[model samples]
Target: MSNDTKARMIDAAIDALQRRGVAGMSFTEILDASGAARGAIYHHFPGGKGELVAEAATRNGQDVRAHMAALPGTTPAAIVDNFLAAVRPVVAASAGGGGCAVAAITVEPDGDALRTIADTAFTSWTTALAERLGATGVEPAEAADLATALIGLLEGAHILCRAAGTLEPFERTARAATELIRSRYPHQKQSR
Candidate 1:
C-alpha cells in the first residue's frame, strides 16, 4: 500500500510534467491529481516539488540504465539497439508528451540544481554503458565518448521522432547510429 501510494505520486508527478512542462506543476496540483494528500506527498518526498521532480527524474534515469543493461551483448551496436528498441515504443505511445526528463529540467531557473541532477542522472547512465563497453575491449576514453554520443543521438531521436509523428526519424537515427558504431567499433549488424 505504501509502495502503491508512492507509485501513484510518481505517476501524478510525471503527468504534471507532461501536461505543464514542469514550470506550472505545483504541490497542490500534484496532490489533487494524485488523489494523495499533502501529508502523504510530504511523507514520501519531504523536499516538496523539487525533491519529487528530482526523484522522479532519477527513477527515469535508473529505468533507462536498467533497459540498456538488459541488452543481449557487450558490443556498442547491441547496446544502441537495445536502447532504441526500448525508447521507440515508449515515445510512440507518449505522442511526445513524455519528453526527456533532463530536457524538461534544463528549463529550470536554478543552474546549480539542474546541473547536479542532470550530471548525476547522465553519469549514472554513462557509467552503466561504460561498464559494458569496457567488457567489450573499448578504451576508457572511447567508452565515454561512445556513451555520450549514443545518449545525445537518442535524445535527438526522441525529439525528432515525437515531433514528426512518425517512426521514420527514429529509424533514420538508429540506422545512422548503427552505421557509426559499425564503422568505428566493427560490431556485427543486426537488422532492426
Candidate 2:
C-alpha cells in the first residue's frame, strides 16, 4: 500500500498543479485529492511538499514522453501530427483551464532545483522529437533545430489556448506546423 499511496499522491499533485498552480498546492489538498492518509506525505516524501511537487513534475514530463512514444508515426512530419494527437485531448479535457505541470514548476518562486528538473524534462522532450526527425532523414543539426521550433510552437500554443479558454491557438499552430513540415520535408508524403 505504500507504493499505492505514493503513486496516488504524485497523480494528485500533477492534477492539482495543472489546475491550481503551486500557491494553492498543499499537503492536505493532495492528501484529500489522493485519498491517502496524512502520514503518507511525510512517509513518502521526507523532503516535504517540495519533494512531492518535484516528483509530480518529473512524472508529468515522463507522461508526455510516454504518450508521444505510444503514438504511431514513421516520419518526422508524421511524428509532428502524432504529437498533436497525443496532447489535443489533454488540452480539450482541461478546457484551457489548466497548464502543464513542468511549466508550472519553472515559474514557481525559489524553485531552482525544481526548475532544473523541468529543464531536463524539456530537453528530453526536444531530444525525442529531434530523434524522430533524424530518423526521417533530416540532418542531425537541422533536426534538432526543427524539433526545438516545433516544441516551442506547441508550448506557446498551450499558453495561448489556456489564457483564451479555447483551442484556437492549437488550431493555428497545427496549420503552421503542417505547412512547416510540408515545406521543409517535401519528400515525406503527407500521410495524415
Candidate 3:
C-alpha cells in the first residue's frame, strides 16, 4: 500500500508536471489527482513539491529512455518510427495539451537540482537515439547530430501541436523525421 501510494503520487506528479508545469503544480492538485492524502506529500516527498517534480521528471525521462532502448529495429527509419510511435499515445492522451515533461519544466525558473535532472534526462534521450542511429551505420558524429536535430524537431512539434490543439504537428514531424532518417541510408530500400 505504501509503495502503491508513492507510485500513484509520482504518476500524478508526472501528469501535473506535464499539464501545469512546476509553478502551477500544487500539493493540493497532486493530492487531489492521486487521492494520496494531504500528508502523503511530505511523507513520500521529503523535499516537498520540488522533490516531487524532480522525481516525476526523472521518472518520465527514465520511461522514455527505457522505451527507446527497447525499440525493435536496427535501421534508422525503424528506430525513428518506433520512437515517435512510443510518444504518440502520450501526446494524444493529453489531447495535445501537454508536451515533454522535461521540456515543460525547463520553461520554469531555474534551480540547479531541477536543471541537472532535466539535463540528464534530455542527454539520456539524445544519447539513446544517437546510439540507435550509429547502429544503423551512421557515422558517430552524424548520428549525434541527427539525434539532436530529431529531438529538437519533436520538441518543437509538441509545442506546436499544443498551441494548435491538433496532432498535425506531431504527424508531420514523424513523417519528416522518418524521411530524414531514411535519407541517411540511401542504399537501403525505404519502407513505407
Task: Identify the candidate with maximal lDDT.
Answer: 2
Please report the TM-score between candidate 3 and the true structure. 0.91
Give the least accurate 10-residue stretch of model 3, judged by summed lDDT: 183-192
Over 4 Å off, model 1: 93-95, 187-192
Q: Estimate, for each residue in 1-192, the C-alpha lDDT of model 3 and write its tens digit.
A: 998999999999888888878888889888888889888888898988888888899999999877766776667777777778887877664455776788777867667778888899888888888888788787899888987887787678777888888888778888887777677676865442
lDDT of each: 0.72, 0.82, 0.81
Better of 2 and 3 by TM-score: 2
TM-score of each: 0.82, 0.94, 0.91
lDDT of 1 at 49: 79
Whole-model alpha-carbon lDDT for candidate 3: 0.81
lDDT of 3 at 151: 76
Q: Give a tens-digit lDDT track for model 2, residues 66-112.
A: 66545567777787888777777776644558878888888888889
